[model samples]
Target chain A: MNDVITLAHGAGGRQTAELIDRVFKAHFSNPQFTGDDAAVLSIGGADLAFTTDGFIVSPPDFPGGDIGKLSICGTVNDLSCMGARPLYLSCAFVIEEGFPLAKVEKYAASMARTAAEAGVRIVAGDTKVAGKGQVDHLFITTTGIGQCLAGVHTSGTLARPGDVVIVSGDVGRHGCTILLARNQFGIDADVTSDCAPLWGTVEAMLGQTKDIHVIRDATRGGVGTVLYEIASQSHVGIHLDSQSVPVHPSVRGVCGMLGLEPLYLACEGRLVIVAPECEAPAILDVLHRQPYSQDAAVIGQVTAEQPGRVILRTEIGAETMLPPPGGELLPRIC
Target chain B: MNDVITLAHGAGGRQTAELIDRVFKAHFSNPQFTGDDAAVLSIGGADLAFTTDGFIVSPPDFPGGDIGKLSICGTVNDLSCMGARPLYLSCAFVIEEGFPLAKVEKYAASMARTAAEAGVRIVAGDTKVAGKGQVDHLFITTTGIGQCLAGVHTSGTLARPGDVVIVSGDVGRHGCTILLARNQFGIDADVTSDCAPLWGTVEAMLGQTKDIHVIRDATRGGVGTVLYEIASQSHVGIHLDSQSVPVHPSVRGVCGMLGLEPLYLACEGRLVIVAPECEAPAILDVLHRQPYSQDAAVIGQVTAEQPGRVILRTEIGAETMLPPPGGELLPRIC
Candidate 1:
């Protein structure tokens, strides 16, 4: 497998199989690979869910994470957010030639560790090597499969007017860290990336209560976009008290100085939940017990009147429309 | 979805849902997204299978195709070559900001068209935007889930002595096409990319015979690498007649003049199958009926005596070992 990729590797023949057996199958041994078009696993009557994601973050490797970790976590989080217990992940690596083996090893280790932490296994994978300069060091794609809860029907459109919005943690950390890392700005905040497996938090809330209307991870486009989407999907409007939406002081400082809206900044280890008003406190309590989600907050509520709108009430009692931003303000910070 | 991705999009909140709905969900819609972790699809009780792949090929958009289409085809083909009837595909796009929307749409169209050609639906997807130059314009990740035929115990390691190896069509065309597209090498050949869905050929052959021992699509590392893999997997030796292995005359001339080995070139559309001696002719006939597979030929046979080895009988009737190449002779051609 250490032999460099040539065109012949993708040929539907011996070499392709060898590569599969050595790199993918060797790492992700399962009974599902028992000779079929797709690996067939005994479903055991649980509802199955599937998700796919591509990782193209610049530098493939970054502080506290890499494309590999993102690939696994992205898929696993999607599975869990859908109320599904993640079971397996399939990965593909599209690598540029001349990528260092050391970097590849670290990336793979990160993937292995994150998948293990998330309680999922890498069950299948493929690798394609492109020419140098044709691609960055590496890009990863991950597909996740999971088993769903017996009677949950969570959806962005499922939110009702009385549903309360809960924040899993502070916002703007991931985006701010990526920005500071890229600019080489000397921020003394010890801003380690917020990238982590959120399955624990998801499981905690799911276990505590089943009244959750919608659960989403606050990632790209930040909280503003998420609220807007829920409003549009559920045909409801959202009103957020900016003071109630928690932001780290450092993140606040950065946003204030740069004129970047913290509300629009990305957060990795965070989620916004729409739940019945009665269950918001319980959900928050459960989330806070998790080490990664201590700062969970109740940020807003869903409404029927201002459908498809997301507005934030500033401390000055002024309201501003919170829409999705124009483009990526920072690149490859993930 | 076309805009730059922010950290909030990945947050498990309203923003994340918006990213899915606006970017990914719009592009890939299927039953898989009906709020389940893994898609609950019925393929006439076929064995469930899954494949995942990442696309980091440079120039996200290439001459004949782009990362988007490759992301779709590469994964679909992985399942298809294994005799799986592809059911659904999930896509994840990691885009960099300032990338053109027009190019993204073109790539999307290509992906959608390729999925249709492969008879699979684009079911679930995710989108992440990175900073410019932090990544290429875009990287696509595709995961395919399918149902494999029951009792199709195909394995690279399963090619027993006396198994016949048949290639679906001419090789090296895809690899050479990229050479011209990228290097401006004036070696003109009327070879359109052999880039296509191989499930049609697999379907044709599977319908004709049940004893197809192994199947693989020749991609990176070309025919030689694939053959080496099969030998290693099945713990058997592969013996080939060089004259019988298909190579276009133009490809041959180019290889000779450029000192490149056609056997090591990448192929997108072609597949190689190992079948029992009794089923070889019928399989070839079934493949011949498909226009995409007109050049199907039996180029070699499997053996037991020299396990884990590949021997090619040259045009001059001299036997030589064709080990996997040491490095990538051609890059980004897939």
Candidate 2:
């Protein structure tokens, strides 16, 4: 079997099998794999939760992470935000011709390490190769299966009047970092795109409050869009104070220079939560205790009046409706 | 809430939601899709099966199908072959900028219709737009979830001595059709690719026999590669009669003219089954009852001697080990 992958490696034959057994299984294999159609695991009467996401970030490799880590954490965080116990993942990669094996290996290794760190298994996977220029280096699709604990009911449409929307941590870090990495912008800033699995942080928050109504990973459209969605879904209004939202100085500085709005940029490691106002402090306390959640803040509050609207309180105390992003301001920044 | 998709359709905001609600959700919405972080489904009291595949076929559309149908059926067939009752699918689309809305809609509608006909629900989905040239046109990633029936356990590694190999139908039609469509060698053929979903045929076979030891879709490298995989996985020898394997005359003619081997050409709606010898004839009979399986036949038999080898009995009665195709003789045929 060839250690290096060619187009034939994904041609559904000996090379494909060997690649699966050697390169993939050798690194991510575990007992739960079962070699069956699906991983069979007992969840002690918990509800089954499944999430699937695709990573098509250009360059495949980025400053903080590559497609592999994104593939793993993207779905794992989806499960986490739903308060599920992340368990297993199925990865499917579509690589373009001429993609270097060394890069693929690096990405695969990162995925294996990330899955291990998150206490999950990459149980099964599929791979395909497309002609050159048909795909952007490589694309990864990950499907995560987890178990939702009993009494854990989360939904975007569950927020109520007088609910608090807390952003788990800093924003715009990921978007700014990727932007700088791509454009060769000479910005001397210690910023790493926040790409991480949030199951641990989610677990800590769940320990403090079961009344959390909604949880959303602010990935694509950032906190502002996520808040707007929650407000619309929950049929409520959301109010955010400019000072309360956690935005790192670097992100703000970069946004100021680039005329970019941090609220419209994507973030990986951060989550937005809407909960009863009374439970906001306790929830923030639990989140603040973790290193990943140290910068968590009470960014906003949910209100029943003027449902389906989101308002931002400016520095001068004037409020303005914050509309959803008109378009993808930054693509593939995730 | 326009029915037609715009450039801002995949922007992850009002337009994205409207597209989901107006077009996608109209066709795909089920009780499982609660507009949440993930779909909630129950797999209790049943064995769960999962499979994922990506489609990046060139031209995006072909004689009989497009990336849409391929994405749905590929994973569905994988699940179906495992004797699993596929229930839900997650669709992820990576669309290139400036892709014709009509073309994308055609693909999406095809997918939605295929899922409906296959008796499965599109429970959750994601959409992303890439810059022009980032993707050829559109690539779709689909993940399927199925429930394995009680008392039915099937695997590629289960074939044993005295088992029989059954092919559901003719081969090479898909590959030849795609070749013709590409106008390779200035050849034109009115033949349509065999791109139908195989769930119905598979369900019929499962209804007749639960003793199927192995089932594989004859794709990519085709029959030779599929049997080789089963043999290696099951550690059994497979003996095939070259003359017994059914190939449509049109496909054979195309292959002969192009110096291509029909045995290594792809087939979309086909399955290779290894069954107990006593059940082979019944399986063939059941398969042939379906229009798509009219050419179903007992192409080979499993043997213990010389395990992990696939031997072909030529028309002249001489036997030779059939090697798996080194690479895809035809690419993007699926």
Candidate 3:
């Protein structure tokens, strides 16, 4: 490990995992400590899911959502991934001293609106101010608590050999939008982030079938990284139907212009779900009826061969390995 | 309100309250929304307490503890304020890109040790890295979940006339220690922060009796601010026996040198507890027997006169009103 932390240590890839294992996991090792999206705990005779995320997006605002909206959606989606019903959330803010009060109000309004849409209550919060230049614009960390539905268990390690891998909606819009928003590449694009609270989308699929094995939101390191993690966790190979993966035209254009793989870009509102192959159509049917997952598609399947690897089958019927995610492609994209 | 945020706005005094009222409360108004240390919620057939706190104390490491230890103590104390047994916590960290990995490990170790002492599990966590100068060093936000003790309802609004106010220990060490650590004033005295997880302290009192009306950690704005807040919330007056208030000798010397009131300085591990006069001795007995609250002393009592004001009676038989806390006395003290 490097003596000093680098951006890669926060990239949500191999480096991040290594940092976690050496520092956090080393000290915070406990029975309930989680490597999953949220920690599942039995509290007060009830199964509960808890998670936390910090939002430090460079520009605080983008085409589809701002930091406040993204903060709520990020934690909500995390709980949703655990097959939990989002219930209550607490947000703590560390604002730069000179940040505008009006902008703060705007963010608060966005948070309230987003929390309401997700059917979660914003219950408690704390605010702190750092000296100007001591902090960037502002950062919001939100923690969520949810109730786990009975008999519904979803984890990255639960993927089976015959499970079909499905994505709730189009990918790469979020990462692409953030990249374009940076305006460093001199590329003009009309792409907006696919950032939305996704409890409804997850609920729709769970309502259709409880056979879902693994569910995860592709946030920091995107769908490709998520597949690698799930594959490693479940000890199964992931075989992707490359052409079947959904990507917005604008996102595709942006990725093409920049020579970036769309599959490795972040998506705030999408979920990579693994379930029995027979339940795919029914789950997709329910997802298509929901607002956030209308573009749900079966993009891959879990395979017994080549465990811990992700294979992408191209249009020419050729297969290649998707390189494992490492390094910091974009910092503060979330 | 100012057009832009100021350090005063996060001072945990009048300005912070105004910000919470104008922005947070205006947008997040709901029945379960909190004006206290933690929100009381009934979830999954059990009463629970939820709260979040952000720690950005300058000089991440201080005399008594670092940011990690303070983070756990802050959230645990918040839950303890509500008479809840803290069960779970989630921490989110936003670190500067060039922070030393060894320092991060040290903080993590402190957090683990503190959490174990508090008997709470560090269940979930997230990490994000900002650019080198984007953040001062690192900031941690911890959210806690606790089981609310049955029939043990404590709130700032529950204080009544004749309720005795007790300080769990000598006050002002934390704020004084941080002030000295900054080396701005060129005045030094040996003082350490009173930062500790106080669930055991609160539990001891509850075991003795559940009649405690209010329990609040005198943090950012100190015991003075908490007394004023309780006075306003309960619509009662507070009368202090000034000489009876416990203050460490070094802290008192520092406060005297700086012309600061020890009562208005922060104490992380101390609690300003209010309860009926009849229960004061029993509560004090329990607090005095605890490790962190050995200096527990009766500092004041709630009164019907001078509602919303705190009066201090001196040993010379003189009475003076303790100024209401406002403005920025010290920024990022906790």
Task: Please tell me which predicted candidate would have the highest TM-score against the true structure.
Answer: 3
In candidate 3, list every pair of residues with a backbone clash: none
Instruction: List model 2 lDDT by residue over A41-156, tens digit each.
Output: 34334356667777877656767887888888888898887788887677767766666655666777788778777887665555566677777878888887777766767788
Worst 10 residues of 3 chain A by lDDT: A40-49
Off by over 4 Å in 3: none
lDDT tens per residue, model 1, B1-334: 3243332232222343454455334433433332111232342243566776666554455556766677777877888876778877776666555566456556777887777788877656555555445455667777877777765667666788999999989897777777766656767665546777777778878888878888888876678777877887789999999999899887888888888878777788888899999998888889889967999999999988788878989999999887555443554454
- Name the docking class for model 2: incorrect
Measured by lDDT, the strongest candidate is 3
| C-alpha DockQ of every model | 0.15, 0.11, 0.88
Expressed as tens digits, the lDDT of each residue in B311-333 for candidate 2 is 99999999998865453366655
Predicted candidate 3 versus true structure: per-residue lDDT over B1-334, tens digit per residue: 8999999998999999999999999999999999999999887788899999999999899999999999999999999999999999999999999999999999999999999999999989999999999999999999999999887988899999999999999989999999999999998788989999999999999999999899999999899999999999999999999999999999888888889999889888999999999998889888878999999999988999999999999999899999999989889988
The total number of steric clashes, by the backbone 3 Å criterion, in model 3 comes to 0
What is the alpha-carbon RMSD of candidate 2 to the true structure?
Answer: 12.6
- The lDDT of each candidate is 0.69, 0.73, 0.93
Q: If both were scored by DockQ, which would come out higher, candidate 1 or candidate 3?
A: 3
Sort the predicted structures by TM-score, highest score first. 3, 2, 1
Model 1's chain B yields a TM-score of 0.83
Q: TM-scores of all models?
A: 0.82, 0.86, 0.99
